[model samples]
Target: MSSPFSNTVYVWQALFLREALDRFFGSRAAWAWLLVEPAMHIGFIGGVWGMMRRNSMGGINIQLWIIVGMLAFFLFRRTAVQTLHALDCNKAFFAFRQVRPFDVALVRASVEAFSMFFISLFILGAAAMMGLDVLPDDSLKVLLALSGLWLFGLGYGLVTSVCMRMVPDSGHIFQILMMPLYLISGTIMPLRYIPLPYRDWLLWNPLAHGLELVRLGFFSNYHTLTVSFSYLYYWALGSIALGLALYRGLETRLVTQ
Candidate 1:
């Protein structure tokens, strides 16, 4: 007999790919929005901020920094937000015998996250061509940062999926949390610039840790970002555990609904 793990892997991969393609083509307009919306938001925000603080926002050029920060941030935020409603949105797919609620959420979140990752790379490449200081100084750390962000999103996505299923009102709770996360995560400004009390406060936000690591990876020339490998590892583990537990408890009920 074939290895059970291999068999399961094949099934999951096939389903994942199929769902991803379906999602991509099902909403071509939305996919286009993903690219254009981020570009416009980054450009508009970066331009506005860069113009006002041309004097003291680090000589590294505000627009490019914002591009890096926003792109990295949008990936996690969008994925987490999407996950909150993934189950409710794909109720039809869950009606099918073969597709589990968890699978629908996982597949959708993965596809969107993966697409944003590639889009981020394309943005970086274009930035490089335009003489933007977007290249990573330590490529390995950059990979680590990306891996951490993806894991954080996946783990959190799973948790959010289950939470929303259990408590329908969680959709609004997620929105409340998401609004403050952008500021705390150091997406618009460097952590070093923050005051001591607030800096310590911000460090507790896992996204901040990930973003700091990414910033250090990219701009090794200036700024200091110290992230503990253990911190990221623990957050990843906790998010996955909580997510799996919640999903297991509510999977059956969610499937029926």
Candidate 2:
């Protein structure tokens, strides 16, 4: 007889492999597309910056800064977005009694994280080879900050998934909401460009904190707003807790709807 804990572990392993196969190998050159997408984004931005004749931003190598911050944002965005549609993505899996909606959500988030890890490594490796200073001054802090962003993304996905399940129209709104985050989260723009007093307000977006912390970790000389991991994690944990509550309360509806 398998204990529930072991059974859950087995389920996760099965789900992970299934998700991995589909994500990394489901389509022709699927893995290649994954690697190419981000590299292309980075290349385009690097080209733009090169044309502008700018060499640095926020006191760090512009190339490294963009590469690190963009990768971090992608990590969080992928995790959250994938998790948001997890239930629908794995609608077929719900046929099994053991496969709860939240179970699929968790598994989907894990899948994004696993894939992004390699994508980051590959991008950073290529950047370093190209003479970009991609080495982190504080690797541990970089890891922690990036982890926070991912956790928050998972939490965001959970809460939003339930919301979308309850009111399908809101899913469209959530999709739209992600667009502004690219700007406000400081992925491509320097918050310093926003002007002093007004710029501070953007920090209200928890992702801003996570992004700054990542840049700070990567370059000791990197100058940016002071950010707290606590702010980001608070949202992460709180959203996850609330999302779980919603799922527990609406388990029947989630599976049905």
Candidate 3:
């Protein structure tokens, strides 16, 4: 019934981010590691694919295409990954009299989201300096799309954070399955090039649609693929509902564990 950004939520979010930022800044190495890890992932995985396609690939340079794709996907992945253990990660905060379980999860998710959002800009800037074209063809649309993806991350984070409490192995299962998504979702390769069978199957992943929409801004000539925003919205909505319900239902049990 109340707005999400009402005074209570706003104040809580502000406090959570402030504390988490202090925690994050205290370890400069971890902050730096975010940039380093993404570069390594892009360099090794994206770079090898670029080399293989250099001779025959058509349209945009694969490296540039992938840099942006990785930028978007990495943000999503980092938020989702950290969200899995959101409660456990902030158990110390939970012990505080003022901190509720949802507060702990919200704070952790918001901090990770804020960190990754900046990292994307840093990555884009670094890409530009290194001779890659990271500028969007249409900045406004790209901004809107980025906003959508960011919201999706927040919702997914909330959902995953709660779900992991009920099912401890969800995080490990997600890690194992996430790699194949990169390959099949057209992060490293263009969808047109993927065979019909695989491409059809990938249609089921709403995140794939979001990624492709983001990709369309990078490659102007490619007609954007149709995506189900409603499908993504369903996950976003479902995640929030399920997460809040489970948390409210089982906070005592999880915190005790």
Q: What is candidate 2's lDDT per residue for 166-209, written digit by digit as tens?
A: 88888889888888998799988888789868798998889999
Candidate 1 wrong stretches, greater than 4 Å: 1-7, 53-59, 95-98
**Ranking 1 against 2 by lDDT, winner:** 2
lDDT of 3 by residue, 1-257 (tens): 76745756765876676656764676858678877888888788666886676622336666777777777777667666666667777676666555677776666667766787787888778878988777778776566555566666666767666667778888677677668866776677666666778777777876677677676766676544566556666766677678788788988877877
Q: How many residue pairs clash (N, CA or C atoms closer than 3 angstroms) in each of the candidate models, in the order given?
A: 0, 0, 0
Q: What is the lDDT of residue 226 in candidate 3?
A: 69
lDDT value, candidate 2, whole model:
0.89
Best by TM-score: 2
Q: What residue pairs clash in candidate 3, if any at all?
A: none
User: TM per model?
Assistant: 0.87, 0.97, 0.83
List, residue by residue over 39-146, the lDDT tens digit for candidate 1. Answer: 887788777786786633444666667777788788777777776777787787666666666666676677777888778888778888987767678989878876
Report the Cα lDDT for candidate 3.
Answer: 0.69
Instruction: Report how far residue 181 has shifted in candidate 1, in Å.
Output: 0.5
Q: Is candidate 1 or candidate 3 better by lDDT?
A: 1
TM-score (C-alpha) between model 3 and the true structure: 0.83
lDDT of 1 at 201: 78
